[model samples]
Structures are given as structure tokens and as C-alpha cells.
Target: MSADRRRILRTTAQLAALTAAGPLLAACGQEAATAGGTAAAAGSGPPHPHASPGTPTVLTPNRIPSATPSSTPGGSASGSPPALPPLAASTPPEVVTGPRDRPQIALTFHGQGDPKLATALLEAAEQHGAQVTVLVVGSWLDQQPQMARRILDGGHELGNHTLSHLDISSMSGDQAYAEIAGCADRLRTLTGSIGRWFRPSAAQYATAEVKAQARRAGYEHCLSYDLDPRDYADPGAEVVQRRILGGIKPGSIVALHMGHQGTVDALPAVLEALQQRGLRAVTASQLCS
Candidate 1:
């Protein structure tokens, strides 16, 4: 063969060999790229879409199927809230207590002019198993020494109601002090024991000065009431009784005038009402002290 023909035949054979190997090499390259892509997607041996930078996914132990939703960074579903502790046992609320645990109620009489009625009240109280506190006017005590002594001797408490039952609020502070102190002094002298309880006339209007003066004159406190029968105005026995029974409570101080017949009439029912509620009627001193 000639040298040029021999070279041409050699080139043609080389071209055919190249064409046959092209498809095989392309398929091998494609297979290698696909394998690399799969490894990257699985987040193994390379960074991938499934992987977050600098974050470690720690598998929790004993996780339930329900717990999977809470595993997300900002997931709403979560473990149960912490439980609240039980409340401790508490004491029942009290209406209120006095110096003594036993319930006491006061029956205070306003005026002091009638000694015969006062003695009758004291006797009635004794009969009904109740202690009494007599608020005496200064002149009344002076005028009725025998009756005053009887009340003192009978072991009843004495309270000053003012010298003339004057409206202390209408007077100057000095006058108010004198009216209270004068009566208190007479009461102390006659009874031979100082009184600490005072009830203003009509539970009348007064300033702090009256209270201050009473305190300065060795009085402890004023006696007032949660229940008022208004027996003094002679509203009638039934009305007074209803008012008292409806308003009465434990540790309440009841006010009624000894001078009124209505009070005397209402006393028996009032006592009955108190007894029904398991309360014992007592003097103001007993209530306070």
C-alpha cells in the first residue's frame, strides 16, 4: 500500500473508536454526579439542604408520636403546664370576738332621773340573769343617792352620761369637757369606783374633743350599739322588739332606755331572742373588759 492511503485508514479507525467510547464515558459521568447529589441531600459527608449550619440535632429519648410537633424551634404544641399546689386549710371567718370568747350583748339605759325605775331595771336584770350598766346623770346621782348606792352595791357597772344630758356638740370644747368630767367625778365619788364608759345623750353629735376629754378624765371608751330599739320614744313594744331582734348579732351592743315602759315590755322577748341565738346578755363593762 502507498504511505498516504495507509495514514487515511489509520485516522478513520481512530474516529470510530472515539465515537463508540463517548456515550459510555457520558453515562459514567452522569452516574457519578447523581451519587454526589444524593449524598449532599442526605446531609451526610457534605453540607446540604437538610442541614443547618452550626446546629446540632439532638434526638430526644422516649419521644411519643405527639411530641414530634413540639420538636420544631417555634412549635405551638408543648409539654403540659406546671401544676398548682393545693391551698392550705384556713379558719372559718368570725363575726368578731370581744375580750372574752363568750358572746356578750349590752343593754344601756340613757337617762338617770328615775331611780325607782332604775332599781326595778336592776332587779329585773337580776331576775332575767343579765348584768346591767347604769349611765347616771350627775345631778340625778346626787339627788337619788339611795338608788345610786343600790346599783353600786348590787355589783352593776356605772357609766357617766354627762351632767345635764346637754348636747355636747352645741357647746364649746371646754363646756363639753366640764359636763362629762363633772358627772364622772360625782359618779366616781358616789360609787367609790371610777367609771370608764360614757354614752353621749341621745348618742348625740360630738367632736373628737369630747372623746379626748372623756379619755383624759380616766374614761376608757364610749358605749354605743349596733341595735337600737327606740324604746325611749315609746314606739311601742312590738316595734321595738322587731327592730332589736332583726338587727341583733353576736358581739352586738343593744341600747334601750330604762325609763320607758316599752323597754320593760320588750325585755322578755329580747332575752328570748338572745337565748335562741346562744348569746348571753351582759353589761357594757363585761362587753369591753
Candidate 2:
């Protein structure tokens, strides 16, 4: 062949080789890009849709660390506590009982008076492995600031029972609003969230205006009781225990008081009776939710 022809033949061969290598190189680059994308995704994890900004995500319902007192009331076992759904506007204004078919009961206390009595009540419940809801008066919480944290640390629930334990049903709209909001404010300050329940003072059920005020204060449920043992009447411990055990049924919300020594004394027997009947004593939130 002539020199020019030979050079032309060599050039054509080199061009064919380059064309054959293009797709292979492109495929390799695409594979590397995909692998890098997968690794990046794996490292970052999935987006948390339900997480609140600036708040630690609670994977389980274990007791949150108390903000005061530097100690938990009673240490909790290692397990997921029951989760309570967020309060919604459509939630019932008053819940007198929980699901009737469930063998669960909620024992709620009116929180006021002597702090020592409150502590004793809590200790009694803890001994029986029971969790109760406390409707704390704002003035009482003001008197015993650490008590709010204590209730939470003990794995119990605290709720708003108004500011001064006033008869909110008879108050003006603004006054009722203040009653609810004041307690809510204290709870939020102490726990980073408002309470889960609200109960009207000096009344079994909240009035329409009171319920509206409670909703405005961030409480969706106003707790009422299906069973009232009249523990506040200073009934003897035997009477208190008899009253509770006599009327209690599945899903009953038993109303009691924290200030009564008789109620505290009756707690052990009441808890034992509940166990004998195969009913679990849970917080109001747990039972209702």
C-alpha cells in the first residue's frame, strides 16, 4: 500500500476503537453515580414527618426527666409506655368513662391541700403498679412547684383543675378562660407541654362555656367521673374502699381526692380489689385514649 493509504487505514482503526469504548465508559460512570446516591441516602436516613422542631422525639412513652428536684419520684421499668393521642377539637368535651369493653379503669384525684398527703397517695399507687391522673389546682401547683414535676416523674399524668379551684361554671367568660389558661401555663412552663385533661372544680361536669374555655387552653378533653366514691367527704377508709369497689365497673372513672388521708389509706385495698377483679388501674389519658 502507498504511505498515505496506510496512514488513512491506521486513523480509521483508532476512530473505531474510540467509538466502541464510549458506551462502556459511560455505563461505568452511571453505575458509580447511582452507588454514591444510595450511600448518601443511607447515611442521612429518612425524614421524620411527625417530629416537632426543637423538641426531642419520644420514641416511647417512658417518663420524661423531671425539670426540678433532680430526681425521679420512682424509676420506671424499661418498656414503651402507652402513647396518648394529641388532643383535637373534635374530642369529647367531657369523658365520664373509657371504652366499656376494656377491663381498664381510671382513678383520678383532685390535687390540692397538703403536699404530704399527695406524696403519700402517689407512693401508694406506685406500690400497686398503678398510674393515676391528678387534676392539679394552679394555686396548689404554685404552692408546690416541684409537685408538678414529681407527678410526671412518677409516671403519672397531671391535668389542669383551674387556677383557684373556683366554680368555673358560674364565672364570666374571661374568668373561666383565666382559670383554665393559668393552670395550662404552669404546666407548659414545667413540662414543655400543656396537660392532657381538664376538670371543673366544685362540679361534676363542665359547663358549656367552661368546656369552650378549656379547649382554648389547649385541653381537648374535660374529665368527668362515672363513679364518685365521695372520698372528699372524709368518709372513713373502710367506707371509701367499699364505695369504690361497690360501684366500679369496666372503664369506670373513679373520682377521688388527693388531700384526704382516708383516700390514701383506702388505696391499697382498692388496688387489690381492682386486681382481684382483673381490672387495670390506668391514668385517665391511657384509659380514654
Candidate 3:
């Protein structure tokens, strides 16, 4: 594996271990509490679908493998998607993939852009028997509050991307706190919870400050992805499809975008490929659960 891949896998494992040991209680929530008042213990979260023994629910995810799948019977991740339970408080840093032995992957989206496009992608995922996660921008959620319930109704997961979708990693501590909590407030107002996950905006990974803010905002883990097709660049559908299909592996967490037509166009083929490869597309919590 490449250094980047190795680093991702290692970090994910360490974070997961720390969470299981229950050391995640001391982040920013002690420093700056969000208006959403996520006073629940840090690391509390929605239960995972196939989590290991003692793995915390909604704790950030696992490392992915690069190998292809075998033609094993019932490896089809064709799941009877479970209705998402109320998410507990957020957990710590990140989970990039699940156990390597499972033929599962998490398909996560940045929730912004056109709602129609977002709905289309949801339909595609549903039709293909997939469950996904959407880390939404607070402002966008303000624009389309209905999407919160829509996503849940479809058996998907919703998390915070940020309040303003700004360059969150570079912001001052107070600024970052507001960004994380602002979104928490919005999600709480619309969905009755601050969400169980956080992802930094405009960066591939969360900085220490951003993670601290997320922690303070009652998020235990920051969601991260291993596969990015860069669909935001307006690459054609074929390119989007090829990039993801070529790179995806077991327990992979994919970063994709909404509002791009090419990404919308690429969903069908991606779903078909995963099914053919004996892999199932699932939400991050489900993949790590």
C-alpha cells in the first residue's frame, strides 16, 4: 500500500481503539458547549450495523482494503436496510473502513447543491439496495429542511459538514466553535439531534483545531473518506464512474459530492459494479458497525 493509504488505515485503527477504551470524553465540549446542548457523553452514537465486539455505536469508522472480492455466495451486501435509530452524541476522529473481512463499503456525500440531484442520488442508492451518509452544510439544510427527514425515510444517515461550509480548518478557535455548533444547532432544530458525526469543510482531513471544535461540539469522531472520485470537478460521468470503480475496496468510505450532474449520472453504474463485485454499499456507521 502507498504511504497515504497506510497512514489512513493506521490512524483509523488507533482512533477506533481509543474510542473503545472510553478516553474520548475530554475534547472541546468541556471548553465550548454548542447551543444545541449536546451534553451526552462524548463517543455516544448510533449503533453500527456490523460492528465488532465492544465497538461504540456511531464512533468514527475503520480502514479499507485494496483487494477485490471473491465470488463467495451471499457476499452480496444486498441488505434489508435497517431504519436508523436516534443517533447518540458524536464520537471521536474518524473511521475510514470496517473489518477487512466484510464485503461492505460506505458511500458518503457532501450535502449541498441541488436538492433534486440529491434526491435522485438517494433514489438510485435505494433502488440498488444501498444505504449512505450525507454530511450536510447547515446553510443548505436551512434552504431545504425537508431533506433531513427525506434522508432518514430512505434509511440513510445525516451528519454535519459545517454551518457555513467555510475553510474550517484554518479558522480561529472561536470561529471554528461557532461553525461546528451552528450546524449542530440547525441540525438539532430540524432533526432533534446535533448529529452523530462531523466532517471538516473544504479539506480532505480535519486539522487538530477542527477536531477539537467538533469534539467540543459533542462530536466524538470526524468523518473521513479513503476514496474520492473528485466528482466536484465536473468530470464526465464515465470518468466519475471509472475513478471510483477502479479505486474502491472492501470497507472503503468514499467521498462524493452532490449538485454535480456527472456524479448523479454515475450512480447507477457504481451501484451495479459494487453488486457485481459482491460488495455492498452502506452508511458509514453501518460499515463500521
Candidate 4:
């Protein structure tokens, strides 16, 4: 071959070698990406489907500050969604109650079923000048995207209740993480933060793996209830009222169901009773903070 032709052949050979090494370099990059991460340390899994672009940034569990209370009913004057407060760290990331020194309690509702019933509950609580927490089910929020804003607009705090309300304790680490993150993504998309708290589904307390997954999903607290009135069983409204009244104490976190009309019926009396006993109702974040 002529000198110029020989040089051209050599350059083409070098180009082929570089092209063959491209995938190898890419593989090294991926390994570097995974090697130092906690999720990779556990075990790699498929990316979460609900994981979407531009999801609000997650707050660090230990460093996130509590949100200032908003005075407006619907949204800020700028019409932006309110930011969620960071949960105070619980070593186990689970809380059954708040400080007993203050005569205040948190009434939290599981968001499910009828949106109208949930609306009624909010309206009723507003009438009593109470602000409670609503731990939203991911699928439920999917059904009613506006409800997330509605909950915040009503001045109630919001928290995660998993993606499908599955029994997260039974899920694998990856599965559990997906459940937590999936719901968190929805919350973050709706509001500017991942809300303040997380609660496990079909159970009161989070398992060890579930707690780790919740931390990964950016929750600092896993809220468990101190008082459950069993209104989900469709027990009579009076019975629900009696159970709530009987069990309530200072700093109690009471769990109720938004799906049940019985809870709707019981709430007016429940609020009246709390007031009569000189106990004020506040959001779970406020109660804990």
C-alpha cells in the first residue's frame, strides 16, 4: 500500500478498537454508580415505574425542618402547594404517641373510598377549628390527584400510606422500597415535598426492612397510632365515638378511616367531646413537634 493508504488503514483500525471499548467503559460507569449506593448494597432491582422526572427533591431524614403553619385555607397567595414539614427522627422511625405534657391530640384519617366522605370529614373538622393529618393511599391519590392539594388546602397535614395499601411487612426489600417510593413520588408531584410522615399498610407498625425502605423514600417518621376506634369495621357511629373518647389522652395519635360514613357521623361528637375535655386537636406534625 502507498504511505497515505497505510496511514488511513491504521486510523480505521484504532477507531474500531475504540468503538469496541465503548460498552466496557459504560459498564464501569454503571458499576461506579451502584457500588456506593445503599439500594445497590441491599440488592439491585428494576427502576420504580412511578419514578418520574422532576419529582420534588427528597428531604434528608435528620436535617429536614418542620413547616410553618399556613393561615390560608386553600393555598398560599402565590397559589403554590405548601411544603411538608420534616418529621422529627424516631430511632425506630415509628411513633405511637406524642408528648403528654400538652393537652393536644392528633386525629389521622386513612384516605380511601368515598372522596365525598373525606370532604365531609374535612369540612366538619374545620368547623371545630381542628387540623388533622391524612395519610393518603397512593392508589387513592391516583384516583383523585386534586385530593392531595385538597388535603393541604384544608390545612391538614399529609403523609404516605404506601402505593396500594399492601402489607409492606411481607414485601421484599426492593418491593417494599418501591411501595414507599411510589407513593412518595405521587406526593412529591402533587405537593412540593414528600409530605411529612409514612405509615405501613395493613399494619400499625413498620417492619425493620420497611423502616429502612421508608428512610430511603425520605420519611423521618413512621407514624403508628395510639388509639384506633375500629371504625373501619362499620361499627355504629356511637360506638366509634365512645371508643375514641374512651381511649384519647394528651398527645394521643388517633387513627380513623375516611372511607367510613360512620366516622363522618362520629366526628362532630368526637370534636365536641375533645373540646369539652379541654383538649385541642392538632396535626400529627404539630403534636409531635
**Selected candidate, larger TM-score, 1 vs 4:** 4
- The Cα local distance difference test for each model comes to 0.60, 0.77, 0.74, 0.78
Better of 1 and 2 by lDDT: 2
The 10-residue segment of model 3 with minimum total lDDT is 56-65
The sequence of per-residue lDDT tens digits that candidate 1 reaches over residues 38-83 is: 8445532211211222322221212111112123232223332212
Q: How many residue pairs of model 3 clash at the backbone?
A: 14
**Per-residue lDDT of model 4, residues 181-216, tens digit only:** 877877776667788789987788888898899999
- Among all windows of 10 consecutive residues in model 4, the one with the lowest summed lDDT is 46-55
* TM-score ranking, best first: 4, 2, 3, 1
Index of the highest-lDDT prediction = 4
Show model 2 residue runs off by greater than 4 Å.
Answer: 1-70, 73-91
Residue 230 in model 1: shift from native, Å?
1.0
For residue 213, what is the lDDT in candidate 3?
Answer: 81
lDDT of 3 by residue, 1-289 (tens): 8999999999999999988766455554545566224534431232221112221112111111112222223232222223444433432356655557799998999888788999899888888999899998776665566677677667788899876666776678788888788777766665556767898887878888888888899998888988998898887999999999999999788999887889989999999999999999988777766
lDDT of 2: 0.77
User: Across residues 1-289, which tens digit of lDDT does each residue of candidate 2 receive?
Assistant: 8999999999999999999999999999999999968954643332221112221121111222224542653543322232455543444769988888899999998887688989999989998999999988765665576778678778888888876665677777778887788777767766666778899877889989988888887887889999998887887999999999999999899988887889999999999999999999998877866
TM-score of 2: 0.72
User: Model 1, residue 235: displacement in angstroms?
Assistant: 1.5
